[model samples]
Target: MFRNGLEPWHLLVVLAVIILLFGSKKLPEMARGLGKSMRILKAETKAMREDDAPAADGTANSTAAEQDRPAVAPVTPATVTKADEATKTNTTA
Candidate 1:
């Protein structure tokens, strides 16, 4: 479904015009240029896909590496409870 609504008659008229304007000798060169343009666009899109792919894996490692960089640990619930009990017993109100 081309959906552009073009039909066989349109193709024949276009072919006839191309034949008259550019002639047979230049048709091969035009076709080759079209092929090269498609290849370049495909390659560029592929490279973008590859570049985006690594970030998904890299994000995990990057965050893990950050965790190792400082005195970043926070006291847990059990430790806080123990500390509170010790403080209360020692205070002896």
Candidate 2:
């Protein structure tokens, strides 16, 4: 495979083109824009990682004691049935 890199000659050509196209005065402005773009990208990437990390490592996040307990009490139909019966009885009567 072709080496994936800009040789010194390539870099020199690029720098010459940039300097010719944009005078030295404008080069500072171009560099400022590039730096701002990089900062924005870095912040967004970090935020994405933080969001994904919580979901990815959620299982490991629970406290040791919490992990030992059942997730929730079994939802027995009888408990709900009694409440519904009461509500219906009151509504009808």
Candidate 3:
């Protein structure tokens, strides 16, 4: 049964302790870093939520767009062998 948890004075004391431990000069820098990290995290979560949401009658168009894209050529062992040979020649010469 915790009543009146974390009053204004409690926050002020915590802030004072933090300021004492990190110093006034470093506090702004730490706050800026925290703000930047929070912004990045917010942006990523927003993007993830958008991706999770279903497209509105656009699935067919997306499938068509995907089909229109050119397929990637597969890498072969011969191509890798050639690349290795070229690197070996350059290193030795």
- On TM-score, the leading prediction is 3
lDDT of 3 by residue, 1-93 (tens): 569897999999999999999999999998999999999999999987876666896563344457799999987675345788889999999
Judge candidate 3 against the unseen true structure and give its global Cα lDDT, from 0 to 1. 0.85
Residue pairs of candidate 3 with colliding backbone atoms: none
Per-residue lDDT, model 1, residue 63, is 42
lDDT by residue for model 1 (1-93), tens: 779789899999999999999989999999999999999999999977775564654563344456688876887776345887989989996
Per-model tally of clashing residue pairs: 0, 0, 0
Task: State TM-scores per candidate.
Answer: 0.50, 0.46, 0.51
* Lowest summed lDDT window (length 10), candidate 2: 55-64
lDDT by residue (tens digit), candidate 2, 1-93 = 558686899899999999999999999998999999999999999977765564564554444477698779677666345787889999999
Global lDDT of each candidate: 0.81, 0.81, 0.85
Better of 1 and 2 by TM-score: 1
Which regions in candidate 1 have their CA more than 4 angstroms from the true location?
A: 1-7, 60-93
lDDT of 1 at 89: 88
Better of 1 and 3 by TM-score: 3
RMSD list, candidates in order: 12.1, 9.4, 9.2
Best by lDDT: 3
